[model samples]
Target chain A: MKSLIIGIVAGILCTFSFIPQVAKIIRTKHTKDLSLITFSALSLGVFLWLIYGLMIKEFPVIAANAVTLILSLTIVMMKIKHG
Target chain B: MKSLIIGIVAGILCTFSFIPQVAKIIRTKHTKDLSLITFSALSLGVFLWLIYGLMIKEFPVIAANAVTLILSLTIVMMKIKHG
Candidate 1:
């Protein structure tokens, strides 16, 4: 139970960590300092994580990576648009 | 196994994703556009993941998050120093 809760919180933190970056970019339209390669790599990585989760049949990993992928992609798009 | 390989690749991608960002910041030293909150929260998240990995006795998880934590913290520090 403790492990599950901790893991869930950890997943949530890592997944939503991209949210603020997205909001900042949208609000300021300033992405000059954000690295396109970083976000692109992250998105690909998260996508693989989602695949791994699916293979392992773990809902938390799948769900977390799904949300993370979207946010990371959004950042990538914003970086491209604003770069 | 295929699963292990995929997971390892995913972990590598995610873990090293921050490298380019760090390199960019060091080169440019411009973080006005970077989101401090994003990196800070990400560092926290990665730290928790390390703890979770330790608790669960998962070497891959622990190792990945350990490196990620350092990289993410470096980012947070750069954000603070530059911003």
Candidate 2:
């Protein structure tokens, strides 16, 4: 139970941290200073994590990475579109 | 062994994904567009993961979260210093 609570808290923190970034981008529509390499690499990393989660059949990991992957990919797409 | 490899790969991906962001910041010294709330939250999240890893006595989790905490914290510090 303690571990589960900890996991939930940790998951929320890491997963939603990207929310503000996404919101900022959407509101500002300015990704000029954002690095393409960073977002691209992050997206790739998230993709791997998603796969790992799937391999291990971990629902939380899968869900977290799935969301993160989308957000990171959005950033990457925004970087391309806006840059 | 397979799970270990998967964990290693996942750790490498997620932990080091911040590198390009850090490098970009160092090179550009422009974080006006970056969101402070995001980094602050991320740092907190990584810190939790570090603690949870210690609690569980997971070496890989500890090491990975430790490195990620440092990088995320560095980003937060850089945001403050450069902002």
Candidate 3:
């Protein structure tokens, strides 16, 4: 039970981490130091994770990765736009 | 098997996604546009993920989150240093 709670907290943190990054990008309109490759790879990876979660029918995994995928894609787009 | 492969690939990509970001930070020495909150949250998040993986005795989760924790910490440090 403790571990499950820890995992959920961790998943929430990781999934929402990009929210500030998106805000920063929008506020500063700069991505010179941000890596396009990183966001791109993240988007792809999280997308796959989402798919895997669906295949396994895991609700937590699917929910977390779905949010993460959207966040990562947002960063990717911002990186490209600001670069 | 297919889902496992996809999961593995996703894990690998997400684990190594920070390599390019680290390289970019090192080369550019700029993180003004990068969000410290993002990296800090990511580091903490991945650390908890690692702990949860350990508790669950899952090798793949442990390995992936371990690497991700390290990478996210690196970014956090770089962001602080460069900012």
Candidate 4:
């Protein structure tokens, strides 16, 4: 129960980190100041974490990173399209 | 040695997940299609992870999430400013 709570809390906090930017982007449809290198690096990193999670059989890590990867990827795509 | 390697890999992977979005924002100065709810959830998740790491005395988790928090926050700030 404790671990589950911890996992849930961790997931929420980490996921929410990108809210402000996402909101701004949605509102203004702009992403010129964003860095492609950073996002690219970040995407790769998340991919690796996904693998790691799978290896360790950590469902929370895998699930969280998977969703995050998709969401982050979408934002990157939008930045490219609208930039 | 193995744990260190795992930590390093996980750190890099998780931290790098935001690279592409950051890069896009930097190059275009836009972020309109992004979702605030998602990012907010992600950030919160990471923050909680940081706390969890600290509670568990996991240096790798602490270091990785701290840096990630800062970088993610920066992107969010930029998105707001330029959007």
Candidate 5:
């Protein structure tokens, strides 16, 4: 139970890290300073985490990475379009 | 062997995700669009990951999150100073 709670808290904290960038990009419609390379690497990392979660059959990892992947991918796409 | 390799790869990938943002902030000397809230959350997340790694006795997680924390913290500081 403690580990689960810890995992959830960690998940929420880490996942929310990208929100500001996302919100900024959405509002400004600009990502000139953001890099494609970085976002690409991040998206790939999130994908791997998703796979790792599946391999380990861990629901928290799976769910967190899934949402993170979507959000990261969205930022990547926006950066590409607007950068 | 594969799991170890996979873990290392995932660690590197995820760790590198923030590099671009860090580089950009350093280069541009601007972070007006970046949010303090997001960076704080991210730094905290990295710290938690470091603690989790310590608790689990996982070197990979420890090493990765340590580097990530340093990099992310650098950006946060820069953003605060320059934003």
Candidate 6:
């Protein structure tokens, strides 16, 4: 039970870390300063995590990485759109 | 052995995902678009992961999260310096 709670907290903190950045990007419509390489790498990394999670059958890992993939990919798309 | 390899691969992908961004930041020295909140949250999250890794006595988890914390914290510092 404790371990599960810890996992959830860690997952939430890490995955949701991008929320503020996403909000800022949407509000400002500026992404020239954001590195495409960084966001792209992040999306790829999260995608790999999603796969790993699936392989291990870990729901928290899967859910967190899935949401992270969406958020990171959104940043990548916005960078492309505003680039 | 397969599970260990998976963990290593996932850890590498997720933690090293910041390398490109760090390199770009060093070269271009632009960080105005990167959100303070995002990096701060990332640092906190990674720190939590480190603690969790320690608690669980997981070497790979500890090492990966430690490296990630350093990289993410570097970005945070750079953002401050260039903000």
TM-score of the B chain in each candidate versus the native B chain = 0.93, 0.90, 0.96, 0.78, 0.87, 0.91
lDDT of each: 0.90, 0.86, 0.91, 0.69, 0.82, 0.87
lDDT by residue (B1-83, candidate 6, tens digit) is 66556667767877888988888899999998999999898898888888888888889889989999999999999999999
Predicted structure with the largest DockQ when compared to the true one: 3
| lDDT winner | 3
Question: Candidate 3 A-chain TM?
Answer: 0.96
Worst 10 residues of 4 chain B by lDDT: B31-40
Docking class of 1: high
Every candidate's DockQ is 0.84, 0.68, 0.94, 0.43, 0.58, 0.63
In model 6, the Cα lDDT at residue A28 comes to 94
Runs of candidate 1 exceeding 4 Å displacement: none
lDDT of 5 by residue, A13-72 (tens): 998788887998888886776668878998999888888878878888789899889988
Comparing 1 with 4 on TM-score, the higher-scoring candidate is 1
Q: What is the per-residue lDDT of model 4 for residues B1-83, given as tens digits with 9 covering 90 to 100? A: 55446647767866765766666677777765554555556666777777878777888778888877776676657757765
Docking outcome class, model 2: medium
Off by over 4 Å in 3: none
Per-residue alpha-carbon lDDT of candidate 2 for residues A10-50, written as tens digits (9 for 90 to 100): 88899999899999999999887777887787788788888
Q: Which lDDT tens digits does candidate 2 get at residues B1-83?
A: 67657667867877888888899899899887788999899899889888888888889889999999998998899999988
RMSD, model 5, all Cα superposed?
A: 1.8
Worst 10 residues of 2 chain A by lDDT: A33-42
**After superposition on all CA atoms, what RMSD does each candidate show versus the true structure?**
1.0, 1.4, 0.8, 4.2, 1.8, 1.7
Q: On a 0 to 100 scale, what is the lDDT of residue B41 in model 5?
A: 92
Error of 4 at A65 (Å): 0.8
Worst 10 residues of 6 chain A by lDDT: A1-10
**Native contact fraction, candidates in order:** 0.83, 0.59, 0.95, 0.59, 0.47, 0.57
Q: TM-score, each model?
A: 0.96, 0.93, 0.97, 0.68, 0.89, 0.91
- Give the CAPRI rating of model 3: high
Identify the superior model by DockQ, candidate 3 or candidate 4: 3
